[model samples]
Each structure stands twice: as structure tokens, then as C-alpha cells.
Target: MSQATELEAPQAPRTRKQRQAAAIAEAASGHVGWMLLKIGLLAIVDAIALYAAFVLYTASEWVVLGVVVVVAILVNWIYFSRRHVPAKYLTPGVIFLILFQVFTLLYTGYIGFTNYGTGHNGSKDQAVASLMRSAQERVADSPTYGVTVVEKLGALGLLVTDPEDGDVWVGTDEQPLQKVQGAGMDGDRAVSVDGWTSLSFADVISRSDEVEKLSIPFSDDPNDGTIRTPDGRSGYRYVSTLEYDTAAGTMTDTKTGTVYRDTGVGAFTAENGEQLLPGWQITVGFDNFLRAVTDASIRGPLISVTIWTFVFALISVASTFFLGLLLALVFNNTRMRFRNGYRILLILPYAFPAFLSALVWAGMMNESFGFLNQVFFGGASIPWLTDPTLAKVSVLIVNLWLGFPYMFLVCMGALQGIPSDVNEAAEMDGANPWQIFRSIKLPLLLVTVAPLLISSFAFNFNNFNLIYMLTNGGPRFDDVSIPVGHTDILISMVYKVAFTGQTRDYGLASAFTILIFIVVAAISIISFRKTKALEELN
Candidate 1:
């Protein structure tokens, strides 16, 4: 064929199958369904983020609002853009890590520097308002106005009407009284307003606590007094016995003329060193840390707990590892009879939940009418959990039982990983089994297991459940103000300080938590560095 005719010739008639395949490939490349699904999911996520941002803004949490906005923007940018494929994959995990781990650590650090415990948990303005509200008393011969309880958007307000002037007003705790344009009245009393729903007698009874605590101001002026409802039907004017001076920052008692000035330690204090409760949270810097070291109430118990913590962790690790290694070595033999049976039996303690096992042990070891005392010890009472010394020993024994099986599994794996030739060479030499284990086998085993040992130590250090369920950290210290005990570790002590009492000192607990993190990090770093020597054995 001529060159011009060959170039101009039609190739062929396309097959139906080929045309169908081409259409499928084009649809796959477009990814329209996938893109739509992705956009739908993104839209839902953006909606949630926007709602959370709005709530945070209303709460005046500016920093958190900023973070939410930034995260939402980043999420949209990464997923929608073609260039940020890696970021799209990483965004969820990074966001979760920041929200759960990084944010928690940062907030704990912030609490450690602030007076964020009970009675010190709000802003200065809130504290002032609370103080004023708490100091109110009904003025003698106070005028009682007919009132109706109404609710709007979950906020309760009072619809008050004057029987004398026929003037009506509505107010909530946050908003002062304002005249309403339209009202639904029952004679002289206002039963409802335009935007509010009147609550029934049953609803008022159900919300008795709220009704009793309701205090709506008469006007914007603090001196004008507040309208308080006693039984939802009648409102009385109540004025504060203590008047606050904004410029001088003092609260003066109108009756006694006692002045309370701002102490800057989160409370207003009198000249006699008495301070009011429910003060605002303030930055106390290192006061919480200093309280850990110097305060007489906590210092002695803290020192005792610190020493016991180190001792408990070290002893627990050593005992568990020793027993576990001994068992692993015995079962590592191929010629051993019923090896699988024995291995399963050894792992029985680990099969059941650790907390359940602890509870069982607690029951078994009880001093009165317990299994040990009644059945085994001929009715002689042994204070396994009651005596201070016995409690510590009991805790160790229980932990060893609970902890050894894990170490057994780990040691067994490590033992199998070690080459048999090394032990053979040691035996062929004059070295006996003990010498081989100590010199050759032990060092090699540690090359793999040292990191695990360090981790076990850290885990045991903060083993809260075992201590809490086993002893409840009892054999209580009689002299201390805090509810710490002889057997309490630092972590248990922190729990007691932070939550178990009438007064929960969260700031102090955060200080202790930071100290623990520091200690564990230090020990882990040092232990990891020491493990480098074991690596040289290879």
C-alpha cells in the first residue's frame, strides 16, 4: 500500500465489549461516587466541628474554639486537596493523639500551676456573683410580688407583676428585670409572657431545688436588691448583707462592718486570717509542688509513700521475673512430660481478670471468718490486710501471683529466641549450669528482656487497681489530715487526695502526677541506657 493511503485508512470497527470496557475505565478514573461519599462524610464532620466551636465560643473558651476552627480547616484542606494525600491519611491519628494525650498532659500541667481544686473552680466575676448571692438575706417587711415561674430554652425565669402599679417584668439569674410588651395575666399576676412557657404546679414541684435557689435581680444595680421566689408563687426582695466595693476590691459586712480584702491566693480574707470559701481559681505557680514537699499534712505520708513505691516496684519486678524465669527454664525442655498441661496451668492466674483475682484473694485472706483463718489456720486471726506490715507483705504476694504469668510468657519467648549452641559451649567448657546461666545465658536473655523488665517496673509503679481493690490502702494513718494509709503507694495516695474525701484537691493531685511522670521517665531513660551493655553481649 502507498504511504499516504496507509496513513488515511480507518483502523477497525470497535467491538461492543471494547466500548463497554472504555466506559468502565472512564467512570473508575472519575471516582464520582467515591468523591461524593467523601464529601458527605466531610460535611457531617464539619457540622459537628462547627457546633462544638459555637458551644465553646458561648462558654468563652477562646483557646479551645481557636483549636477547633483550625482543626476543621486543616481537615477540609487536607482531604479535598489532591496534593496532601499523606496528610489525609495522617490527619485523624494526629488529631486524636493531640486531643487525648497531648491535651490531657498540657491541661494537667496547667492545673498543677493553678488553684483548681474544690471551691476554686470559676472566674473572678463568677466568684463575686456567687459570693453576693450567698450573702443575701430577706429585708424585714420586704414587699412580696405575685409571680409565675416560666422557662425558655431550658433557662428558668420569673414573671413578676406588681399588684399596686400593674407593672410587669421578666428576669433570669443571668439577666436583670426588663419590661415585657405582651403578657398573659391572671388578674394582677402574670401567668405567662410572649417568649416564655408557664410551668405547671407539678413541673414547679419537680424543680423545687431550682425554684428555691432562683435569684433574679430587680435591676442592673446591685443595691436595687434581687427578686427571689420561695414557693414559685410569691417573690420577695432580698439584699446582700455584705456589699462589694469594686474599686477597692473589698467586701464589707453591712451589719458588723467587717472588711474582707482580696488575698490573691484565690480568696477574700479578713484581718484575722479567716478566708471565705468558693473563691475563684488563680495561678499559684509552684505552690502545689511546694505543698507536696513542705506541708506538714502531706509531707510525712508522701515521703513514706515515695519510699514504698520504689521498693514495691523493684521487689515486685525481681520476684515475678525470678519465678517466671525459673518456670520458663523448666518448661523449655523438649523432653519435659505434660509440658502443655503445665504451661496452661501456669497461665491460669492470667486467664482470669486481675481485679477479680485480687478480690478473691482479699476474701480468702480476710482476718475474721475468712478461708485462711477459718479453714487453714485453726481459727487464729491473722491480719493479712489490717496490720500495716502484713498488708505490705500481702500486697507483694498478691502482685507476684497476678504478675508472674505475664513474665513467664515473655521469658519463655526470650528463652526460645536464644540459640542453644551458646549454652552447649558453656557446658562443654568447665562451666556448670549455674555458672552458664549467670555468665552466658542470663546476659544473652537480658539482651531481649531488659526493656520489658523496665516496662514492667513502670507498670507496677502505678498499679492502682491491685492496691485499691486488695487493701483499699487501709491500716489508715491516724495522725494525718489527709486520708492516706501505711500501705498506700504514691498513686493511691494521689487518688485519695484528689477524690476520696470531702475536699478534693485536684491541683495537688496533678502536682503528684507530674512528679510521677518525671520519676518514671527518669528511671526508664536510665534503665534503657543500662540495657545497652546487655546489647554488647551479642
Candidate 2:
């Protein structure tokens, strides 16, 4: 009776106005800080969105601006609206998945079908400007103009005084030399312009490299010669040896009278197999893929790399699993002493980063100064990382050291999880240890481990870090034009093709990546299907 009265005392009766006033006061007292925080965060987001909108508009990136505006509006609506309960959690994940995964994959696929390499990276206008600039040569009878080296916003420009009329001009790499007023002349040359700062003699000497390299277009027309200063004091008129016919879509060599036509293959080629570089990107569908098999220069090396990749992945998975399983079995005895200490010591290599471990092993495998040769082999010159066969052996050994600990962990857990009754029953039936393991425990272990082995194989197949850090795909193949070696796997080959050379073949690398993806996916699917057979052991 007392407890009931205590509970009922808090519900004391009151007037209608008093109840309404209490409800409003409770709400305000509890939520004021949280409301203020939400408001402040929203204000910050609005400010950032507005700033981004202004930048995108100024850059004339309309497609990107529209996307930003729509995303900002959606984000605001999702957070502010009371009806959007689940969208707040799912929106961020969906956006990141689309941007990082879907967009990257699609862009890479698009690149695989195009000639987007060294000389074919940018747009048509940039390529045109570059072609004209590269072929420019000094005209024999060109006029000499007085010029002053000037700077604006960290960019170098030329302040030119026309030799004939004495008109002052200023221009940078992106800007054509044009007439400007408000010139402050030192003697006969316009040293200082209105919007540019004239460099002192000391400054010109300090930035001699930049001053020598600076070439400003004389005007908008490509036919007109550029203004190039030789000693930062005198400018000369240089015209391009190649004349471009914009309307006719042709480039003619002024010296040889060879007409180069746009072959629609990203380059301008002449009739005799000559090509002018600085070409723009163009799509050449399936040519990159076909070159992998059909082209003589790439096919042999690619085939060898593909074979080595398979062999390396297969050997790495098998060796690591067997070694780890052996160690786990030896240490799984209940009566073993100091087994925990041994286990910790074994896992030490795994605790460090894989790339760091590979680097350490690379140093330790050096023939002349390595710990293995000096301390163990009595300074014998063993080419563990140089010879073709020894390099493969070294890679496998190092991979075994780095990979066995993870397998040991998984195999240990899987072995311990098996029921003791099954082994006891097998022993009671007069079965030997080997028979029991082969028939009973091993089958059960496979039920859990087969999927993991497939994943490990896939990982080792694309193990770029080990190859890159250790050998850098060295001991180059002498017979092939492609920059591949005996130690180079498919992924490493792709990396070298795309980045290491003077001509980075991004399209071919992307094609190789797609092929790798298809191979791995197919193998994984088939192996997963085979693993379904192992479930019967469960």
C-alpha cells in the first residue's frame, strides 16, 4: 500500500494551463544544447557548399557543379527532414561505394579501350599547342626585340618592346604577348609593366633556367612566331618548321614537303611510317586486348609472365599451408611446455608490415654482405636474388616466412575446434594417428579452410608489393622489348608498363588488369563450387 501511494504521488492533479506550461519547459530544458549543435553544423555545411558552388561556376565545370548542388541539396534534405529516418545512415555508404568502386572500375574499363598514354594524354587544343611549340625553330631573318623578364603570381612572363614601333607587351606561357600600357622603362626597354613586376639582374641570373625556357606566343595565330629571349635582354622570332592546316586537318613539313594526315589513331602519320608525337587521346577498341596475344613483341613475354604468376601463387599457397599445418600439429599437444612462447616468437614476423619484412629479407639475401652468406654460409657468394632460378627460390622462401604465421593461426583455431570425441572414437576402433588424421580430422578441417585457401591464392596472385619492393622485377629479359623480367608477375608487368617507362602504356596495363580480374573471378567461382563437396564432411 505504501509503494503504491509513493508511485501515485508524482501524478498529482493540476490545471490545463499548468500542465501545458510544464510540458513546454521540459522540452526546452532537455533539447536546447542538441538543437544548437545541429544548427551550427548545418551552417558550416551550407558555407562549404556555397564556396564549392562558386569555385565550380568560375571554372566552367557545369557537370561537376550540378552534381555538387544536387548532392548538397539531398544531404540537407536527408538530415533536416523528420520522415527520412534510414536515409541518414545508408546515404554515405551508397555514395562512397558508387564513387570509389563503381566510378573507378568504369573509368578504368574506358581507359582500356583508348590510347591514353604518354603523348596522348590531354585534349585536342593542348595537343595542338604542344605540337606547334615543339617544332618551333628560329627564323634566320627575324627581328630582334628588347625584352624584360617579368613575373606575375609565380609565373614567368616576357615584357617585350616592339623593335619597329616600341610598343610594350607582357605574356606568360598561357597568355599571348599583347600590348599593355602604363610601362615604366629603364632606358629604351620597358622594365616594369602595370600588372607585372620586373625582375632584377640578380633575379634573372638566379632563374636562368626558367628564363631560357620561357617562350611566349606572339599572338593568337599559330602561324606567327613566338617571342623567346636568349640572354633575358633580347628576344627573337621563332616559327614552327611544321605548318598546320586547321581547316584541311593536315600538318605539312616545311623542309621535306611531306604531308602528314590525321590517321584517326591518335597520331599524325606520313605515308612512309613517320609519326609526329604529342597526339591527343583516341579510342581504339579491343586493339590493346588483341595486342596481348597477336603482337610478337608482347605475346611471348606476357605468356611467360602469366605462367610464372600461376606457378608462384600455387607454390606460395601450398608451401605456407603445409608449413603452418606442420607447426600447428607439433604444438597442439596438451602437455607441451613453453608452447605459448614459441607461438609468440613464430608470429613476430607476421606482426610487422609485409612490405617492411620483404625489404629486410631483401637486404639479408644480398650475396656479398648479407647475414645469410656471412654468418651462415661462411661468406660464400650465393646469388639468392640475382640468378633466375635462385631468385624464384628466394621469393618462395621469403613468402613462406611471411605467410606461414597467418595459416598457423587459422589452422590452430580450426584444429582446436574439432570435437575430441571423433578422434577418440577413431582411436578406439584401432585406427593409427595417420589414418585418423587422413579420414577424420583432415576432412573436417577442409570444410572450413578450402574457402580461405582460395582467397589466399587470389591474394598471392596479385601480390605486387613483394615483387616491387624486393626485386623491382630485375634481371631483365634480354629477348623481349617489353620491360619484364624473370621475377616479374603479371601485376608487376602491368605496373612497369603503365609507370616505369618513358612511354606509359596505360591502355595495355588496364587491359591486363581486366584479364587478371577475369582469371581470378573464374577460378574463384569454380573453386567455390568444388568446395561445396567438402561440406559433406560437416
* TM-score versus the correct structure, for each prediction: 0.91, 0.84
Local distance difference test, each candidate = 0.90, 0.89
Q: What does candidate 1's lDDT look like per residue over 1-538, in tens digits?
A: 6999999999998899999999788867997889899999999999999999988986789998998898899899889786878888888999889889999999999898988888898887777778888889998988789999999878999999886788899999988999986798788888988889999999999999999989998776665779999899999989998788888888888889999899788988999988877788999999999988998878988998899999999999999999999999999989999999999999999999989999999999999877989998999899999999999999999999998999999999999998888888888887998998888788888998899999999999999999999999988988887899878888999899889888888899999999999999999999999899888888
lDDT of 2 by residue, 7-52 (tens): 8887768999999999788867887888788779878878988999
Clashing pairs in 1: none
Model 2 stretches with alpha carbons more than 4 Å out = 1-61, 139-171, 175-208, 229-236
lDDT of 1: 0.90
Clashing pairs in 2: none
